[model samples]
Target: MDKKQAQALGKLLRLSREKAGLSGRELADRSGMAASNVLRLEQGTIANPRPETLKSLADVLDLDLSDLYAAAGYIQPEGLPSFAPYLRSKYSGLPASAQRELETSFAKIAAKHGYDPNGPQPGEDETE
Candidate 1:
C-alpha cells in the first residue's frame, strides 16, 4: 500500500472502530491482534497489513472485507464472479433506515424469485 492509501486505511479503521463503540485495545482483543499492532495500523505506521489481519479487523469492526481489500490495494479481475464490491460501493453509505428498507425489499424480491438466502448450501444436507 502507498502512503496515502495507508493513511486513508488508518482513518477508515479509526472511524469504523469508533462507530462500533470499541477502543483500540477492545478491537485488538476481539480481532485477535496485538493492541500495539492495532494502534500502529490506526496510526498509519504499518503501511501494509496481511490479508488475514485485515479480515480479522473487518470482522471485528463490522466492515466489509472487500472495502478493506480495495483500500489495501487488492483489485478484483475483470469478469470475476464477485459483486460484493459493486454492491458495497452502491449501497454501503446509505443511512441505516434506508439500508434496512432496501434489505427488506431485496428479501421480498428473493422470495418472489424462489431464492432462499438461508437455505442449505449445495454440499449440506437439507434436513438438519
Candidate 2:
C-alpha cells in the first residue's frame, strides 16, 4: 500500500476500534494478536499487513473485511460489491432480525459517511 493508503487504513482501524469501545490492547486480546501488532497497524507502521491478520482483526472489531481490504488498497472502492453480501455470508448464525438490523445500520452509516452512492445525497430530499 502507498503511504496515504496505509495511513487511511490505520485511521479507519483506530476509528472502528474506538467506535467499538475497545482499546488497542483489548482488541489485540480479543483478536488473539499481539498488542504491538494492533498498535503498529493503527499507527500505520504495517504497510503490508497479512489478509488473515486483517480478517481476524475485522472479525473482532465487528467491521467489514472488505472495508479493510479497500482501505489497504487491495481493491478499488468503485469496483467493490455491496457490503450486504458480506453481512449475509458472515452472520448466517445471527437471527433474521439481527441480520436485518445490521443491514439497516450499514445502510445508515454508509449514507452518513458519504459512501453509499445509491443513498440520498447530502441535502437531497428523501421524501421526494
Candidate 3:
C-alpha cells in the first residue's frame, strides 16, 4: 500500500475498532495478533500487510473485509456491493426526521412487496 492509503486504512481500522467497543489489546487477542502489531498497524507504521491479517482485523473489528481490502489499495471483490457509501450519498443531506420517514416508507413498501428483511424468504420453510 502507498503511504496515503496505509494512513487512511489505519485511521479506518482505529475508528472501526473503537466503534465496536474493542481496545487494541482486545482486538489483537481476538484476531490472534500481537498487541504491538495491532498498534503499529493502527499507527500506520506497517504498510502492505498480508490479506489474512487484514481479514482477521476486519472480523474482530466487525467491519467488512472487502472494505478493508479496498482501503488498503486492493481491488474490491466482484458482486459485493458496499452500501455505506450509497446510503451516505442518498441520505446525508436530509434531516434526521426526513431520513427516518424515508426509511419507514421504504420499509413499508418492501413489506408490501413480500420483503421481510429480518425474516426468512417468502417461499422458504423456517424448519429447514
Best to worst by lDDT, what's the order?
2, 1, 3
Q: If candidate 1 were superposed on the true structure by all CA atoms, what would the RMSD be?
A: 11.9
Clashing residue pairs, backbone N/CA/C < 3 A, model 1:
none
**lDDT measured at residue 114 in model 1 versus the true structure, 0 to 100:** 88
Q: Write the per-residue lDDT of candidate 3 for residues 3-50, one digit (tens) a residue.
A: 888889999999998999889999999999999999988888888889
Q: How do these models rank on TM-score, best leading? A: 1, 2, 3
TM-score of each: 0.62, 0.61, 0.59
Alpha-carbon lDDT of model 3: 0.82
Give the alpha carbon lDDT tens digit for every residue of 47-106 in model 1. Answer: 879999999998898888989989888775665433334444568888767766776777
**Clash pairs detected, candidate 3:** none
Q: Which has the higher TM-score value, candidate number 1 or candidate number 2?
A: 1
Off by over 4 Å in 3: 77-128
In model 3, the Cα lDDT at residue 91 comes to 84
Better by TM-score, candidate 3 or 2:
2
* Distance from true location, Cα of 60 in model 2, Å: 1.1
**Candidate closer to the true structure by lDDT (higher is better), 1 or 3:** 1
Q: What is the lDDT of residue 80 in candidate 3?
A: 30
